[model samples]
Target: MTARVPHPPIEPPGTRVRFPDPVLAPSHGVLAMGCDFTPGTLLRAYRSGIFPWPHGDEEDEGGSPLVLWFSPEPRCIFPLEQEPHWSRSLRRTLRIHPYEVTVDQDFAGVMHMCGETRKDATWIIPELERGYRELHRLGWAHSVEVWDTSTGERELVGGIYGVAVGGAFAGESMFHTRTDTSKIAFATLVTKLRAAGYVLFDVQVENPHLASLGCVEIPRREYLGRLDDALEVTPGPLL
Candidate 1:
């Protein structure tokens, strides 16, 4: 892969600006940006197609200030018009699934589980958690939850969360305790997004898992163009 040089910060008039990929070095396939990830600052970053990902302590401060900014070369996205591959096994699981799906329920709990690390320590510190929770409260961020009656009402099996800007839904993280649970939640969310006229589902960076679900990459310049169009359309509720 060719190394990209990070570009100097472009202080544009609006609260949004794209961080040049060439100047921002990626670590473990991610990048870092933003001085303070407070709710206000983080919101501004997402609006501009920038997001914070937790990084190692060796490269960043111990907690709140440690996340990195990333702009992947081939941004993974699911187009609204295309049908993502839903395998026979996955379809069977969805049909026989005992889990019920909900939106924006237990948003904080989902975040807590996502931050937990059985092996390495977590980077979603107190400040980051609080900030995202605030975004949820303000209706700018949301969570898709999967629950099972056998596991009890409070037990959430799978879900995904992210901030929604205009027609774009920037997916942050997802977790699942049962097979195909997260996939079901994601497929349902996509169905809702498409029905509501959303044009873009920004997965940020691409991975093999996302590729299997039909996500493809576009150049940063082209991504910015779609983002501009997406931001002009109104968003639909996740529920």
Candidate 2:
């Protein structure tokens, strides 16, 4: 028998210098697993068509939950001209909702609200919060806030937060404490982003909640192509 040659061990998925391409990532859109949620890392991930989401401990081999990076196959996005579906009741609520909409007022506050867990279950773990907050300080993260003023006091009731690069706004999370509150906040966000000449609004993945709001999915290859176009648009301040 000839002398055997040794092969190199594979590095953990996504632990390499760059993210895995769509063809290399898993079907569930998980490009790679295991990474620290540093602000710089997060920025690089987003620009590379990936974002970090916390995995349950079950995904781990008995230690702390792991952070997994994803680039979903059918990536979700909001068309530049897409208008959210407005139910009759939502339209009425919009007319009577005594709330003020603001941008980047309290980005950390928005992230905290989104991180709030019900029955102690959530993916926005502590580390993720700190990471995004740092990104906010760097002007890469932003929030759209909704404040309730019907009671003569400004109470934060709804908001959405995301990272924006060039003309692509990658929505990370959103939260609401009142009916239609977050919905209206999202609408206002759309208006502002449109006026700002945003060419893409990436939502990461599609769900019923997002589909109702006009989020649609396209092949990852197509999304990457669009991402390239969006990133070529003149950079502008999103906050």
Candidate 3:
């Protein structure tokens, strides 16, 4: 049976918050700060090519940690139609790896593991976590889970989660408890996205690990232009 997600009513008030123009943001891409994580607000920000990435313990007027929004320059992305380069070992693992892959089966569980596995320097703080959870419930966010079933009990060994808007996907975070499992989850995700007709796979930033998987960087202007095109395309169903 295909799993069905329950829908719940979300209030519309907080979504009305306005954000600054990302193009006008400073070189560091700190466009604006201070907004609640309402689904509407998040959707609007993403639609405008902006995303919240809160830092430190800075507080807003309401005494809560201020939300910092960014639209980075030299954005990192994975071309959906192109396959990443994989090592010979990784290819072999893909052929013989004994793990199960599932989608949206346990979004929260994936999230909890992502944070728990990276307790030091993790950015999936409490508020942001709740925000993504709400987005998941509303069908805007999704997760890809990798499980180890060898013990006859399914253990979540790796996973990735992100928000999808139209034909664009913003990969937020991923984690792995076993070697190469995260890479396995990532490869599976790219295949699924390409099959689903997704155009843009936004990694947000460049890292050595991602570069190893063929993620590349482009100027922010180019990213925004591509984002516009991606948003205009009728999004294929991805669940």
TM-score of 3: 0.91
How accurate locally, in lDDT, is each candidate?
0.69, 0.75, 0.82
Give residue 103's error in model 2 in angstroms: 0.6
| Top-down lDDT ranking | 3, 2, 1
Q: Which candidate is the best by lDDT?
A: 3
Ranking by TM-score: 3, 2, 1
What TM-score goes with each of the models?
0.81, 0.85, 0.91
Across 1-239, the per-residue lDDT of candidate 1 in tens digits comes to: 11121122122234344455532444333554544655566666776677776644534443335666666565778777677667788778877888888877777877776666223436676767887877776666777778877845457778787877778889887777777777877877787788867888999888787776667887766776788898888755554
Q: What are the candidates' C-alpha RMSDs?
A: 8.3, 11.1, 2.8
Q: State candidate 1's TM-score.
A: 0.81
Q: List the residue pairs that clash in candidate 3.
A: none
Q: Which stretches of candidate 2 lie over 4 Å from their true place?
A: 1-17, 56-64, 82-85, 117-121
Model 3 weakest 10-residue run by lDDT:
1-10
